[model samples]
Target: MTPTDLPVLTIDGDRVDDLESFTREFSTFLDDHTWRGNLDAFNDILRGGFGTPEGGFVLRWVNSDRSRQTLGWDATIRWYEENLKVCHPDNRADVRARLDRARKHEGTTLFDWLVDIIRIHGPGGRESEDRVHLDLR
Candidate 1:
């Protein structure tokens, strides 16, 4: 299935009032042209939980500028390992596990991480466009 075809998991938040707005913006951000090309790869990363589950989120780009020029999952994984260093400082174990799974191309570690984050932070929790390191904690 395609990235667009994948379902978006709902997450809870501190203020239920912000949920609607967050969902709208989050959907827009993911739907942006720059993101569409690599939506699958981003989904792959999201499925792995490189981003935080609460407060903010992240997207891995093959290029530093985050332009969706590449068309491969390996590039997404490489982007995470080479450039993006997400995960809370205390969550190093989680990060390392994700790294290892990504390296081995395992699905559980990656998708569970993604589901957990989305469940914890909801959509608005994703990182801001200008943020380099998304710290949800």
Candidate 2:
């Protein structure tokens, strides 16, 4: 995707605070390893939260599959797992369920939500359209 097509989000401070707190707690859920698929824990860390901060959140996905397939996938997955501090689910339902929960949660922080955005859009291995001015509010 071109720079013009990149997506941007408004992540405010209040939202950032909630996400930071969640990240800290979520970090406790992971093992000190190089790689692991932990998406559920990550979702749990942000579900049912709210964003009070003033800034926006931006979501970007860089596809290195052609250049580094394993590395890209591993890095993306690891980032998601580590950020959310949760394990990946076996089916789409489980993943969706977790996201539903997090969205339901009140007062989601910015940092945490940013992680969520990344996780949701991380798959497919192809460059995506730049999504800007998405209404997160």
Candidate 3:
């Protein structure tokens, strides 16, 4: 189907500064947007069937410039720290490594991570059939 035929589901970056607010923005589309509050859950949600359409759709993130700044390093560091606190014992080392890298600003920021996750369901990604395009504005 043409891109125009698909629905446009928007998330205001102005409403998303971290994972908490990030998931909360979904209330605009879902009756209960309360979520697992993690990257894995975010990825799963993009797969559709919750409240989002099962077919192709556009996830337009408006005010994305502001979101990039808000969901950047600071949010990444905080997420990693939280993961370290609750992640499986065997995963502690990896979480620590990521936290260290985040502290050093040596890897992808949280914003990049979110974009990557959403894009993975788009045209050429691993789950391309889902056709969940991310329109970052």
> Using Cα atoms with residue i matched to residue i, what is each candidate's TM-score against the true structure?
0.27, 0.21, 0.91
What's the C-alpha lDDT at position 83 in model 2? 44
Per model, how many backbone clashes are there?
A: 9, 41, 0
Mind giving the per-residue lDDT tens digits that candidate 2 earns over 1-137? 32333334323323222333334433433346211224454433222222311221233222212213322333334343454545444555654554455455433333344444444533331211212222223
Residue 71 in candidate 3, Cα distance off native in Å: 0.7
lDDT of 3 by residue, 100-121 (tens): 9999988998889889998899
Number of the top lDDT candidate: 3
The lDDT ranking, best first, is 3, 1, 2
In the predicted model 3, the residue pairs found to clash are: none
lDDT per residue, candidate 1, 1-137, as tens digits? 11232233332223212223233333444433232223345444344334323323343211212211121245436645643365467867766766676677664432234334433433444532322232232
Native-referenced Cα lDDT, model 3: 0.84
